[model samples]
Target: MEPRKLLSSLFYFSLLSLLSANQQVVDSAHHHHHHRHRHLFDFRPSKLFVFGDSYADTGNIGRSLAGSWKQPYGITFPGKPAGRFSDGRVLTDYLVEIGTALLLIAAKFVGIKSPIPYKFRRVGGKHLRNGMNFAYGGTGVFQSTSPLPNMTTQIGFFQQLIKEGVYNSLELQQSSVALLVLSGNDYSAYISKNGSSQGFPSFITQVVNQLVLNLKMIQELGLKKIAVTTLQPLGCLPFSTAASSFQQCNGTQNALVNLHNLLLQQAVAKLNNETTNDHSTFVILDLNTAFMTVFTNKGDHLGSTRFENPLKPCCVGISNGDVCGSVDESGTKKYTVCENPEAAFFWDTVHPTQAGWRSVYSALQANLQQL
Candidate 1:
């Protein structure tokens, strides 16, 4: 070979060797990073146990009884009603969404997912480890309009499952986090039953007292972390504001709700105090403040396209006597839906739309960090 050609060949060989060495170092560093990423966060909970009402219920209600199973409930999600009270996913779904998103930061932080409804656990298969949801629409800590299990009865079901060896104490102690949502169904039932305003304060006290007992019982069951939600702004619900054409909230009703929340906060604090060794096992998720934040500053919280009227619902009955999802004997539709469900805040008279829940969840970031 010519001298120049030989020199050129040597130069190219050295360059190729250097490039190969650099590639090997990059691969090794990437492997180290991926391995570290998997083990960096040790905060993931293995199971999520859900309790309370329509806000957290996945599909615990019977198709014939719960309006959630009727049309327009799950339209934004599974493309049809799937027994969720809202037009799509509810508060629990958004919780799972946040948890799932955490996986991008740390692979081992598998994050909490919405538990399977207790009624569907027989067919849950591999999903049983995700925990169980005992929530039923229209039910509360005490009895309400719905015939489904009350909070006490719901806990009974959990105890029954435990006795049946479905979940061992060690398993619960090691990996469970319970979420309790009591969103004012009891108050609704009280008013409907003609319980006078004079008795409202005492009734709220009873409700919170029972709720505190329920929270303590859950802790004694071996689950270490429990999150109980405060009542949302009741007067802001479409049902209360409908009298004002969704223009103004009923101050009297909201005052009652505030009283409930205040009592709840104190109860949670007392529970936490009793468990000093555990250090804040009972966390208060302030849905009340979060809802108000979104309602009061819809444009600021949602950005760009806000709810046209934050108090106005996206679905309603055609007449005064009807309700959302209502149909006549001839199967004629008796309700109307808005042009854009995503642009609305409330889904029906009581529940928030999917977008509404999403915005509320974003506002709850500061509080959820405690979880």
Candidate 2:
């Protein structure tokens, strides 16, 4: 492929992968476990039920389909690929690391490690203690991008788990938390379907409407504490910023994101108002604010980690017709990696480096207290 076509293809990959049913989210910026979570350092939940796209998927996507299952993706942390979208741990790993130490979900310091993915549920023995990860790559609140399973379908899987007696009603009510992450794949689908930008806001409303239904369903299904992430600034993703040489963001796209977030906030607020009497049920992980903080603050959390180019990716195709983990038939790597992935905010076109996620997590501690 030509240079321009390669860039165009990468851009397409960015949009499509942005909300794949599951992948990476918040990192410690440099995998800094020492960073204080003043609010959640002692707050521990019995189980965490994670849902939605690539942003929170620890390892749900199939090995054959996901680039995350390939090499150089998890090179920074475990020294090998283990189904993470970034170079290291993502939000889910941080949330479940052992005793405030997220060395990849050993259950953060007295907390449970990242739960076993649903695919491994049958074979995952002790690993199933914390909860289950049902996220799939390339999925959304409504069906889009991939046919694997939408959020509703993912919820149905959870519902089945509950029916199988994997989790009792007491755990769901007293100590379980559900993490829901929805990237912009639905909007990507809308654009791909030739939906006019003029109709985008209405579409945002429709999307949020469906999201609320999912949220309510989770509540009805029994989890008392649910954490849903606000959309990150879509314009700041590398694919969007690449057009500006990674020096600026597309305000028009961000404006649409703001609209979706506003409607979502309102809906969550209403749900809380009607549902909460003693303790709140819904918590918003403001990925938008946390992500913006990292973009502006650079390497605030890491001892020495810094993102010189916050909107640029650390791993990329070497040239035309390749992607982050692309490999040639001759068993040669097709992508180039940066000297240090921790210093780059993005790992690939659509996801954050572990360091980037850590920075975002540092900013999100206050909100996690609610969970």
Off by over 4 Å in 1: 1-43, 100-109, 299-305, 367-371
Residue by residue across 300-368, what tens digits does model 1's lDDT show? 253743876999989999998677788899999899999998899898887888888887776665433
lDDT scores in order: 0.69, 0.69
- Least lDDT summed over 10 consecutive residues: which range in candidate 2? 21-30
Which lDDT tens digits does candidate 2 get at residues 1-371?
23223223323432332321111122221122223223233344767788876777778877766788888889987878888778998878876763222211222335666878888888755677788988776667776545467889999999987898877777777667787877776777677667897888788888889988999889888775576777788888887787898899778777777777777777766676576332335656667766776787775444356778798899898886677988898989999999988789899888889988777767555333322
Clashing pairs in 1: none
Which residue runs of candidate 2 sit more than 4 Å off their true CA positions?
Answer: 1-44, 98-110, 301-304, 366-371
**Local distance difference test, candidate 1:** 0.69
lDDT of 2 at 138: 64
* Cand. 2 TM to true fold: 0.84
Looking at model 1, residue 207 earns an lDDT score of 82
Q: Where's the lowest-lDDT run of ten residues in candidate 1?
A: 13-22
